[model samples]
Target chain A: MIIKRTKSHIAEIFCNVLCVFVITVVSVNAQKLNDDFFSPKSRLSFGNYLFLEKDYLRASNEYKEFLKTDNNDTVRFKLSESFLRIGRYEEAANNFKSLFFSTSLTDEARLGLFKSLFFEKNFVRFRQYRLEENYTTEKFSHDIDRLNYISYFFDSEPLPDSSRLFSAFADLNRADIKKFYYMKKNPDTKNPVTAALLSAAIPGLGKIYTGEIGDGITSLITTGLLVFLSANNFRHDHNFRGWLFAGFAALAYGGNIYGSAASAQIYNAGVKFNFDNEVKLFFEKHNYFLPEFDFVNR
Target chain B: MKKLFYKYFLLIEIFVVSSLFPQDRLSIQFDYANKLFQTSQYFDAITEYKRLLFFDEAKKYSYKAYFQIGKCYKAGAKFDEAIKYFSTASINAANENEKLSVYFEIVRTNISRRTTSRALQILDEIEKENTNTFIRDSINYWRGWTYIFADDWKNAADAFSKIKSDHELKKLCEQVEKEKVSVTFTKAISYFLPGAGEVYSGNILSGSITFGWNLLFGYLTINSFAEERIFDGMVIGSLGWLRFYRGNIQSAEESAKQKNIAIANKILKYLQYEYKGAKP
Candidate 1:
């Protein structure tokens, strides 16, 4: 069938042929592009994607891969942040330290380094690092000072004056800081020696002073019963039973003194642990006073 | 005519390339997102899927991205966010089949979250909408799983039984039910006999101790009373015998609960790692 083809039909045929050719070319180019989707440049965005997803381990890995080709400050900061997020504090501290120069990220990195050390629960080491000017970006020194004051509460170091210790914190946090400071300086800690003496003089008074009311009452009742049993057996002329009861009474009295001293130490340890936990939780909830990432603005 | 043809052809080619280029890029992005999900990088997978949703101009794979994001959230144990994305997926689904798949995913997420009622409601909705036997059986299967997660073995068995007479899950549910000791029965036995509940709950050592304490103290109290030692009798009876007797009953109840928990956990562990069938 020889069909009559108009000029418009000829134009349409060329349009269809051109579309097919263009689609083929574009698809081939696209396939090539897709094959390199995991290249280093792509890995940077992929790492950021993982970071935002809170996939810290994989995000860090991606960032590390990207770092082999690119020494970007933002990526370095994110890599450190990823390590910090996953609780690899030592690695995080080292990563953050690499950014501790006169760059735009210096103060943040210094702050991040302190935070990393703080999370490691090595307050002593943190304090030592804080004192070194090499690690100190002076702009964030006040932040470090706050962390240092927080460190005193965590350790057995003698606390600085309340005014000096709380100088770094804003007024909003000063009250809580002061509470922790006073708790350290004049800790509601029982004196072990005094506790032992008190328990020796009165069977369970030491436990009561150590804030263990239930234990104090139990100790008193047990000791009183043993002593009474010994006296009763003696009055009744049962010498063997009386001796046995007296022996028990003596052991109970000695144990009460030792236990009271131990109780005082446990009380002090609990106070320290609770305070440290509160401080850590507070800082974590507030994101350590760091600047928010302005990804949208960028 | 040839010049005009070439101009029109050039215009069409540019349009075609521009249109097809972004689609290819988006498809690659989807593949990368799915790779993340496959590698168990769920949190990152969700982010990638959201990126696809952001640039999906024609909404070609928007619902698919939403469904995948829901799955990623569910894998991360973020049930609330999982449900949120799944709801969005169902809303954006292009057809009945896609919506149906999303609905099943929502049911599975609810079971994981132990939101049994919501899962049941969805299953009922599916049941009313379609009469396909396969769909009905699938709903019943998930219902059984929900009951299992809720620790209601009898209900689980009942749900499974509705699937088929000799189904493997039905058998498992029945076996779990048979092996479980009734907590109420143990508590009642302990109330009547001080250490009997502990022995019933398979705690021989504690049962012996509890019994021995009650016996020795009981004997001491009676002997003290017979010897006219009223104060000693009262103390021994009240503090020693009564305390141990009460403790025995309480411990018996606790042991029963622990036993039930252990049984449920054993089955749950098996299901998680070794069971060869559909799972929530």
Candidate 2:
């Protein structure tokens, strides 16, 4: 009977020890979760640090953790924004989609989604979303029209001439005219291989088509001079020198032909690139002339 | 016993969650790599970055590593290698900006190597693949430099003018175009006037050498004939005086050629090492 009583006493001691361990563990975890969610100022500070450092992925994660606890729409919006900053467009779109259903951030969410889709070049979905979502009315109507105009760049149809379709763009007062023309005309440039072949057939022709008249002329003249020199040297009975000059002439002639055509192709590609960037920037600045999601707590 | 179970579970949960959360290891590595890059220890920094890629937590750093490697090669003037690495980086980069940066490096490196045609080719590729206005403008600005290096001053001027801004590059290209002398014209001028090109090239010493030789030979030929020793005069005048006169003409031509080469080299050297402007 005395041994049984001693065993029971030891069991009680063990239970108490176990209880303390559990409580300590629980408190520590609870503290961490609480710290992650409840401390807005700290979380914001950390998020900002990551953002400034361009650690967008990490910033998004931190903001996500903050949002889990805080559940503040502003914080959620910012978390999605971090994803956008990192070019995690799909994730950003999904996050924005979540906010779209219920929150004062619905308009901002829709706009952010549109931007992400537009950047991802998902025209079909972007168009669908544009038609469905209601953008808040504001005084920057001209800016909105510009954004709408640039968005059409991602559309499937050919762009109309700025002089005809976008004469109004002239009055819009943006320094992106070159950018627009570059985008509009880029797709129409002849094929690179074909241009290269054309140039190969006749020096500088490719460059001329690409609007590099000076380069074309120089290439033709240089190649022609080399050819003349080589032929003259051969006629003078300097066979060794003639052959050497001929070889050099041939190389230069061939290379220039190749280069000219290649240049034309490159010029077109550059135009296309500039167009996209200009359009994206227009949207990034919210058309620069348009009002963005500037809801004053209405 | 139940309380003990809950407590242990909580501790385990906390430990598990903490472990699940990604840490600053990637960040720390990027910071170190950036620091190494800034210090110009590019090769060693590259190794550190490749280690990060091995971990492969995020594929983004891999692109950064490749881009830096290209840059390191470019810095060392190994442009062919740099272009290869840049192409590799562009192929694998996660985003448009990263890819564009890689393409930019390819153009820049090629231009630095005096492979203007290749740089222009890559620039076209960039233009086709990219859709950013700022990037396009920046690329065009560099394209102007490519034309300049290829000795197509007029095209360079046109490219810069098309930028439609107070872009310093446009003004610089215009300056280059205006200041440029036609190579053929310069060569022909030297052929016409023995020392004119030397004068144009600001080589008084060479000009004087040419002038002195021509004058001395002229006097020698004239005086030798006046002496009335027909055979002696013919031989001396034709072989000695005439030869020296011809040699002076050749020397003048040579000096002008050298001067032209020097000018071209000066422009190339500035572009290669000193000009604080877009290159490719």
Candidate 1 C-alpha lDDT tens digits along B1-280? 5776788777866776675665687797899899999999997787678667655779988899999999998999999999999999999999988988999999999999999889989988998997888888888898899889888888888888888988887888888888888888988988777788888888988888888888899899999999998967997899888898889888998998898888888888989999988777
Q: How well does model 2 score by local distance difference test?
A: 0.68
State the fnat of model 2: 0.00
Q: Model 1 compared with the native: what TM-score?
A: 0.72
**How well is each residue in B1-280 modelled by candidate 2, as lDDT tens digits?**
4555565567656655554354345555667777888899876565555545544555857787778878877887878878877888888888777777777778778778988998898888888877778877877887887887776767877777767656665665566555545545645565666565566656778776776766676676677678865645675678676776566555556665675566656666776698786554
Clashes of each: 0, 12
The regions of model 1 sitting more than 4 angstroms off are A1-28, A35-68, A100-151, A161-179, A239-252, A281-297, B1-23, B28-59, B69-100, B106-137, B163-168, B187-275
Candidate topping DockQ: 1
Native-to-model Cα distance after best TM-score fit, residue A110 in candidate 1, in Å: 4.7
TM-score of chain A of each: 0.79, 0.57
**Each prediction's DockQ?**
0.25, 0.02
